[model samples]
Target chain A: MNLSRTKIGAILAAPTVVYMVIFFVVPSLILFSYSFWSSESYRVVPDFVFTNYLDSLHSAVFWKVTINAVRIGLTTAAISLVLAVPVGYYLVYVSRSQTMLYLILITWFSSYLVRIYAWRTLLGTNGVLNAVLLQLGIVDHPVDAFLFSSFAVTITLVHIYLPFCILLVTSSLSEIKPDLIDAARDLGTSSLGAFFRVIAPNAANGLAGAFMLTFILVAGDYVTPQMLGGSSGQTTGLLIADQFRKTGNWPLGAAQAFVMFVISIALYFILVSLGRATGLIVKRRTINPKGI
Target chain B: MLLRILVWAVLAFLISPLIVIVLFSFHSSPALSFPFAGFSLRWYAELFNNAQLGSAVMKSLTVAFLTSVVTLLIGTTASLAWLRLGKVGRGFIEAVSVTPIALPGLFVGVSLLVLFAQAGLQLSTLTIVISHVVIALPILIVAMKARLALFDPSLEEASRDLGASQFQTFRRVTLPLIAPTLISSAILAFAVSFDEFVVTSFVAGTETTLPMYIWSMMRRTVTPLINAISTLALLFSILILLGAWLISHVRRRSAVAARIES
Candidate 1:
């Protein structure tokens, strides 16, 4: 039978909205509420108290780990951009084969566990890197710094998240018309000049978006640091995870998570404002390709 | 020239992990050290014979399949509804839906666990399935919405003008048009579900998925068996991804052909 357009749309959309509300929105809210509640003897007591927040705020370890997380996050973001921008530029402007681009990206779908495990194997005392280094006589002994350190954590995360940056930057680059570069060239601008003046500005949003996404993902990651970050690799994520899983201190964990969430949201807004102030956001508004 | 070398070097770094994993999976030694003592397939055989791992693999597949089907149904309807709304409403809803994806997986897991405990619901495979759907739904919805953005509204309007019911138009015209995107989105949903580890770790309660199994194995000790399992898992992911690419490629070709004919 016939139905009005609004009725049909509602019928189609109701399930998704309802599902998300129940599963995502409500749980997150509960988690937030739990941050204010206190725990007793390893059980969440559900009593309102600010002790967990106070404890987290007062703890030197908390700030130190949080700072460590932020440092790793920024490093991963910078390295990923450096590596991905060139490849994205090459694929969009220089490369002849779109198939090659897809093939490279397709490999990203491989298991995340395998990616970390590969690095672990390579970085371990007798792992491939050490074996090769010793054989080459580059080092007198196996490098203890390679595995179970902050360095390993950063390296593995960069490898894991780089593909996403490439994909985003490539799409942004693709939005630029070939003639825009040609126009700049006709004006007697060098190719590098055209890139700096036209290409980079237009792709700024994508670059910024990539950085933020990678930063959040890397900072919030528990497994990578726990696996690769030996003692030196401990970050805020691992600390929060310990509260929930090992200590059963749900209230404390909830508090720590909210702290992280608040800090990240604040940082994100700062970046957005800075981006707008710098005129980088203007290029995004001008080129609305609308294609995913 | 320098730029090309840098790009290729990054590409090599990206693929090196997989190459190392696959190569060592066949090493005869129990130690994960290099310089293979010769090659053997014993780890693969061991992987198959391990009952717990086999069960976990099946559980992961079952959950992934269920997640994809559920997400496809819910996300398609939601995204379509989303397109009908005004810009503000769409933006608000999209933001709310992506919350699970944006939040840390550990946070999502713990939050859901607390919610379930409060609701007096036991942690079961069903709980696992529900949590998977929460995360998987966003990917499908985003993919479907992107595909839907390119859809022509006049086709639906014309079908309606020709006296077809809304359901009839959707079934005959809209469904066929979006089937390729739906398939690819399902593949994406499946892949996300299959490899999901962190959230599953928090709520899995006695039930083990493949990643959970791998984590336990790694925590206890590293073995060639783990390597074999990882290699298999990597191959499975690559196969699914390739399937998705091929489907989308074929659809692109046919769309091009249709344009020429028109």
Candidate 2:
């Protein structure tokens, strides 16, 4: 029985397509509509009003947390990528064994909340870091800034996410063959020059993708920031979570979430353009023979 | 030499937190500070006696099991379609599938919350399962697609040429070839759901998973029991991952032996 390709595709895909439409797509639309609606006395009223968005825009708390979220997000992503690149480079180009890659991935599966709690224990006032500091006579007193600060949030995020960034970087870098680097070297270029002139341009899109993905996840993270982030470490994620859990305002939470989403999308475009303008990402016109 | 050192240093940094959690779980005193006050099993003893923690673990296991089963069914069919679909259909499906992972978990969670509220559905273990399936689906689909991409279509064609029906060919031919990948992806889906917290936090109104239980404990006070529970969670995750690796390793060895014999 020969079936048409389209018919076969539809048959195979119908289950998930229908499931996503019901559970994912429809919910997102409903959430978007809720953003325009208003809530009164902990109840969402179905009406079109810009108060949710407008109120959020005018609110000082919104801007403060959003800025804080962005700062933590950018710092964590930058540190994660900077730390991941060397490992990714070594795994892809310098090493032949898969053992290191697997070991790194094992760290990723060690549970997320456990890692955050681990950081809290390590950085608390009576924590190991302070204990070690006192033992070394580096300071007469335990440093209060070690935990419950943005610094704690940022460092913990970097630790939790660095392995993920490495996986992304290695996947992207593996696509650029060693032959390309050898060719650049043969053309009177130094190793560093070959990397920047040959590799940086080719891997730019994937690198940018890795960076932006880490940023989005980190910025949107509510758990880590809340766990370690003291009063000053509050972020948009925590604030938005509050509207739902504590404040009982679903519409407002939905609106703030959409605002954060738009900001993330806007940052993606800006960063990509920045890369293009700086000539780090070169656009090539070569067509793939495989016609993917 | 410098690059190797840097890579090892990063790996150490990545692994340190887990090590600290495990070490402190055995500390004699409740203090999390160093200069170990000798070893003890008191926290582990507490872990075994805590009825709430025991129940939360059961709930997490049930949710993870259900989520992985549903994800496997949907993801397998979807990935097969992805391999068979035309360019436009494939692209649309791929984009829709991957969007969940790309966006923040909070977005998915809040959106689902609004959705359930509008639909007038009560939040329970059922809602948590639904949300987890959504979270785990993208991961399973992506992993399955990568495996399916390397499959040879001609074998299926040959099965069809020999008078096997499409379904028969899939069961007898396509299924066996991809069974290893299916098992691995299922394990991965289980791991993803088991460790999921952010989305679970939103949709879970009154239902408490292990992470939720842990969060409550952390908020209430600092204790070695938290460390003991966390250590157990870490060990469980590591065991699951190791199971996946071992299965793949055994499968590869058998395949090599079969090839040599034939």
Candidate 3:
């Protein structure tokens, strides 16, 4: 006997739906509500109040930390995109090898903490780079700023998240049929012209998605900043984490998280819309393939 | 030529840290500085002798294994159901499931911590597993959904038309078709769970996972022993990735061969 389609769908989907609601959505609601509650003397009061939100809004430290996070996030996203697009282009258009893609993914699968630790080892005052520099007499003393600064955090984040951007852009570039470029070239478009006129438009979605994903991950990253940022390496994630673990200020932490969440969502939509507009313009250009 | 150089440079940047960590793992001195005074296996031995780290590894393995199995089962079923539904219903389900990955891990960790506490459940290994499932599910679903998207509906329809039940059709026709995806996704889920630290930190209570172990050690002090453990972890990760790459490579080659024969 066969079940109706909807019945089968419902039956199959129920477990995941129920699981996510109990595990994901309910907890999110709990978090949301907690943002409206207040915390005093390390105890969360269950009454509704806007103090947490107000504190987050009014606190100069909150803005500074949030802006710092945004700065790192954007810097990481930009650097990763710049570094990765070439690799993505090389893989899809030049080498066309699955081996290269898989090699990058292998690095992607390697432990996240290990990667950060490696950076810590490399950039420390007595670390590898400093050792080399000192031996070369490039500096009179070790650069204390290299290890614990925002610069270190940005560099580490870019390294950690670059593989994802490459994957994203490579997937996007692959979706642009080689024939489309050939068609544009056949119509007397130069190679670079064909890239701008044909390829970049088609690849915009992946580029945007990559940027957004990396931005959110980098922005929300607590570990890297906490580990490498030293005194200056504070991010909103570390702050939110501090609330729960150190201060036991759950309401304030939850409020800050939602604020970060809103900022991420806004950035995501802006990138997406920009990508769509670019894609649309490219489609219009391609309509006149012979006119080139 | 220019692009090739750039690609290689990026690759170097990506892998340099891991190489450095592995190099420093055998240093005689505790300092992370270069120019290793001497090579020794003492740190490796210390890594093994640390009972807390040993237990944390075991606990992490257990949690990762359970996470893989649970997410694989649930994600596959949900993805299959996704194929049967309207676009709106499918989108809703996808959004609900995938959003967990997009949100900050701290938020997921703290929120889950609050929820569990509110329900009057004690935090333990069980709570860790539940949180891990939430983290691992989206990745598993993304992999399974990609595989399912490629699957032909005609095969399943034909099996049903020939008087097979849905389970029989799935077992005979669909399951074998997506087995590679299932395996790879399971590996991915396991890797994510194994390497996870943030959520585990929040919900772990008094327990430890390997990441938490590594973290506490790093926070307390850097040692050659930590480097030794990191090197081992890196090696394990490389082996898993190589296995995954090889499986997909072999599958692709066979698929190409089958196409030629047909």
Candidate 4:
């Protein structure tokens, strides 16, 4: 399988390289430029200002809603991780048939919008969930409280992101050697104990990747809250959206968007370093320190 | 176990709303309410009967299809090129292209609006497709990248050494190998563009995509027409997902066989 590295390289590297430079690099600065430009009532400024970033930090409402969005983001990440990790573990470690493996993946491909839209229909006052609840005498009347609550928003996001967590976690679990589990069990460790000590710690990188990806998605999402959260669904996404669409406050919106932009990057970097460090640590200590 | 109950309930929860939308679409009632007095297909009948709504759906499908095809072509070629970049350049290529997918869609929408305005471009179908291609390009890149990573670059050289030209080698060798990924990426891109209401609302002049149409309808009056509209429109996405799922299902099964063969 000898390959001419040069010829193979030239043929594969020409088109995308140019398109990436033009569309991605050049246009991204256009976005970054807007973040720096001053805007009065959505009108772009000829002059740049450092004040937008300052203002973003100082606004009480901005901070309040941002904190709310972060809370929701972390909560969504946490809930998804908790719910998916074990199931992903089960899918990779326990499932025997290829059919079951794809059943998990098929669950991932379920229409995303339809899944979100389902929440609206189910949670709405006259929706099916309420109808069922009322009929069952669980509640005497329809619950408007179900729809548009932050709880509803969080729950919906968890459902939406659960499949993502599963995909990452199960893949991570698959990377573990099957022999390691058998070795632990044969060496007088209980099956459950072996999983916790040997398998759980080994799959740390995947867990962190799942968490970071879900957190980033949740933090950036406005639709989930706007559609399901109602009047109270004020996250930074909602704020930035309003500033752009309704308020026509481009300066403020750009400022808020930049803040969120920075936060997600920061979170991603933290997770990246953590992943790298853990992977290195795992590699260096490839043998158990106990040499058991 | 508690986990099984919870997981199934979540799946049910995920699936039930869309089913309800379909059910409501068929409801004869003018307003959305449960325990309907009767059932009829007027809403769906009316859905097709309305020319404006019907055409908007058609326009959205056309726009999404165009976006998918163009993005796929661009992305597939780009992915091929990306494979040959040095490690540092490859890292840059990966980061720069995927950064759009990471950025908030709201930011990209507004930023593209500015870019379009700055270029003095009109908010025509072409502009809409251009912007969507930018947004959808990264996703296509990602799909193609996975396939590219799997591709043995020497295979192309093998074709070339066997006396085929560059284009011929690619046409016969590379394209077929990555065809599944290319097709799936196009479908996924279409799904993204089709469901995209927020970005479309910003950039789409007076023209409406299906999501934009649904958004306006949801606000003005929660009509039975909406359920009908969504029912007809969202089926495209469902069909896409199911088809992709089936393909991946087969691929996984085959992989197991390959593993055993080895």
Candidate 5:
């Protein structure tokens, strides 16, 4: 009738743990190993070599697209976060209603491709934005540049990801009590000053997380760029996707993917350290010198 | 005041694209621009008649259904296990579970593609379902963990003390209590799987889900038909999400009322 916690835990956890191990962990390891393998004429040969990595690193297209991806990703994440902070601030500190939060969540769940199509419709030469511009006599002709440029890709990425960033920012901000801000204000700090001094430091990690998660997702997104990015907006994600989907080079694709993955991780650390350098993220060790 | 305006502006920005899509789906003209020529259901009619789209819809529903069922079982058990485990065990499961979603979909998709290719599994709707389970399971586990954290353990103990078997204790005591959360989480899982694209695109091989269908249509041509189908897909996901939200909201209210009565 009685069971130990360990026994019960094992019984319950076995299924999911086993499932993740097979589907998630094993696949990741296999994919990581595949980066070292070679692919010839659509067949992945299992000889271990660094050519896949070496080739991707040396290739100009790889570097070009990776740089482009990083630019788009950084721009989108920065804009999304900048816009999200005010909304998240309003929701967490200013407003008590859950309605606005739910609305944002709804937008987050709205189909991804649908939004891309919406942007395409809005930004296309003869699309809505041009229509309005033309109707208002804002321009002589529909701008061809709006639809198939890095600008279009970045704008759509911001729209698609802004709600998500807001959610993350809001949750992060929720952990810091409003009373902290109130305390700061009572001590002669201005509202904006309190936000930067009191709020930003405490919420820096969450904000950084929100930023990097958006950066990673936006950077890794292939579909939006393919649909709206045109030739100039090509990203490493699209390149990597093609290696598997079109090029039939699994090892090459896997290598490119790992490269992108490493870049995202590196960016995360860089941003965190940047935050520390700026005093936005205080070190826990410094805060608790005796190791608590 | 400025902050409120900014919040509303962001919300409006968030909602505008969807609004535009829904509105343009009803446009009589082929133009995707602002001048709404007239209203018509012709695109919806076209949506209904497209055999390929209909098949993709069916496939999507089937995959989503299978995904939710699998995710529910795995997630519920994992959540229960999480509640009972020591810190180290819980931490391990939590990390393993949450990592898939924390990473980008492209990574998950490529890794799974490689996994399937290496394992000699044919890419099919089944593969799509497996991948969906991986992505959806994390969401369900996180939601269920939150709900289960609020669960009182003594209730289960009391059921066991009354000569109920462990299974009976779960069925008679735990299941009913957590049924609202379970239903909502399952619906959420279904919504997630249904909207999944990037991962599905990799493992789908030749098979097309609705999003993939939409993608192909977008690539082939620009049409109001795309609008109609997208509107339908968006509406379907929104309705499911609302249902999940409403269920949880109602449960919270009823729980509050029960507390007041007690």
Candidate 6:
């Protein structure tokens, strides 16, 4: 650890690079190869074919699922970010509830499977929420209005990912200096105006970073849909997972994965660019936008 | 205001569903139905007796332990690499590690299955662990790297300057400096492997870990026992996370103390 960049670099890089190459990169390399290959009897044949890729690109089923996946990914990020901002502001700026927020975040460290099960119990037809609602006369006896829908899937995802959202946003909020907000308030800005103008603008990069993080997480997820999405709640993840599992089409799976991977990489590049394209905000007193 | 009520309500919504699962597991009722007529710990008691469930939990623990150890080893080394490398190489490693996060894990599962199938490695615990290692490696690297970044490089230098060998300095100085992160990383890897259903589903679909067992059972029929199992697993993770957080807070305070003393 005391060593310079070169010595430390070689020692550290060798094992992980080799490991990633053999384990991480090779498997995916085979997957990429399978993407270009044909399938015979559910096994990847040697023949290089573009049919799976073609079908994936042209098919309505694939497109619909892809769109749904993208929509869910983007929506979950937006909602989680919205919910996250105020909660993050409260945690980082207002509340004396560090331990409580820490407990909430700590719970997330558990297996998502366990967390999914918890949601399953709550969201299932004969589950706790429905039963309580019926007893409270919130609706007629146990209406199946909500569970196992795309809405339910999105809700579950946002809830699960909200912790990460809050953490990232809170950290971002913490990075903003207190004096900027005070300065804005002293210049005749209301509390709300000052918050939106001073704190929010300063935390834009962090918020963008948080949104990208959540969006990427929601995009690549296969679990929320598989467990909660039911038949109608199909997302790209569920489709690709099935291609590997029930369909036994490694080529199709790989092709589908490759498409999703490309989209994610595209988004990731967008994230990187957004980080560098920091010229949007006019960083001067007259352009503070608080008075305006 | 309405906002405070709403935020707290949302928080309750966020936290209660999970806590409710623990409560639901104690239902005297045979199935997973709510509006319990009475309270009973039969499922918890039955969980012990349920041979398959018990075995699945055992299997999950075993897999998790192995995955944690392996992920920690690889992650620590990777962090060492990142810290040592110049800026460009470090950036490259950061981008590379993000693959586990950016790509769907199902793809990782399929890729690993294909690799093992090609290599004639039997679809068993080995393939499962390797996949778990891949899935959990990025997390370990991120967490460990963050901790490693905080550690003072001069501590190792000081030890080495006192005639300690590089290996000895690492063992005494660098290792202790990063011990908390390593433990936290191991716990995180354990949680990832334990809760991992996707890759485990692909590679060890037939081989039942706790999550796989719950998945199959849910598909077949939801049961109170499943809730009990989930709650148990969640509680275990919550405890580990608490430890990780406690260590982090301790580190922050200790860093302040070190700065003050210096």
Scored by TM-score, the top model is 2
Enumerate the candidates' DockQ scores in order. 0.62, 0.78, 0.74, 0.40, 0.82, 0.58
lDDT at A39, model 4: 77
Give lDDT tens digits, candidate 3, residues B1-262: 7778889999988888888888888888887886779888889988878889889999999998998889888877887787777777788788889988666688789889989978988889899989999998887787677667777788888998999988898898777677677777777888888999889999999989999999998899877787898889878877777776567568757866876999
- TM-score (C-alpha) between model 6 and the true structure: 0.88
Worst 10 residues of 1 chain A by lDDT: A283-292
Estimate every model's Cα lDDT from 0 to 1.
0.83, 0.87, 0.85, 0.73, 0.89, 0.78
> What fraction of the reference structure's interface contacts does model 1 contain?
0.61
Q: Give the C-alpha miss distance for residue A69 in model 2, angstroms.
A: 0.5
Candidate 4 on B172-215: residue-level lDDT in tens? Answer: 87776666777777888887777776577668888987777777
User: Any runs in candidate 3 off by more than 4 Å, and if so which?
Assistant: A188-190, A269-292, B247-262
User: What TM-score does model 2 achieve against the real structure?
Assistant: 0.96
Candidate 4, clashing residue pairs?
Answer: A12-B80, A12-B81, A13-B81, A16-B78, A118-B17
Better of 1 and 5 by lDDT: 5
True contacts kept of 6: 0.66
lDDT of 6 by residue, B11-56 (tens): 8767877777777777777656655667888888888888998888
| Chain B alone vs. reference chain B, TM-score for every model | 0.94, 0.96, 0.93, 0.88, 0.94, 0.89
| Model 4 docking grade | acceptable
Evaluated with lDDT, which candidate comes out highest? 5
| Candidate 3 collision pairs | none
lDDT by residue for model 2 (B1-262), tens: 8889999999999988889999999999998988899999999998899999999999999999999889889877886787678788877887777789888889899889888877899999999999998888888777777778878888888998999988898899777777777777788888888888889998999999998999899888887899999888888887888887787678767866886999
DockQ, structure candidate 1? 0.62
TM-score of chain A of each: 0.90, 0.94, 0.90, 0.85, 0.95, 0.83
Docking quality tier of model 6:
medium
What is the Å distance of residue A110 in model 2 from its true position?
1.6
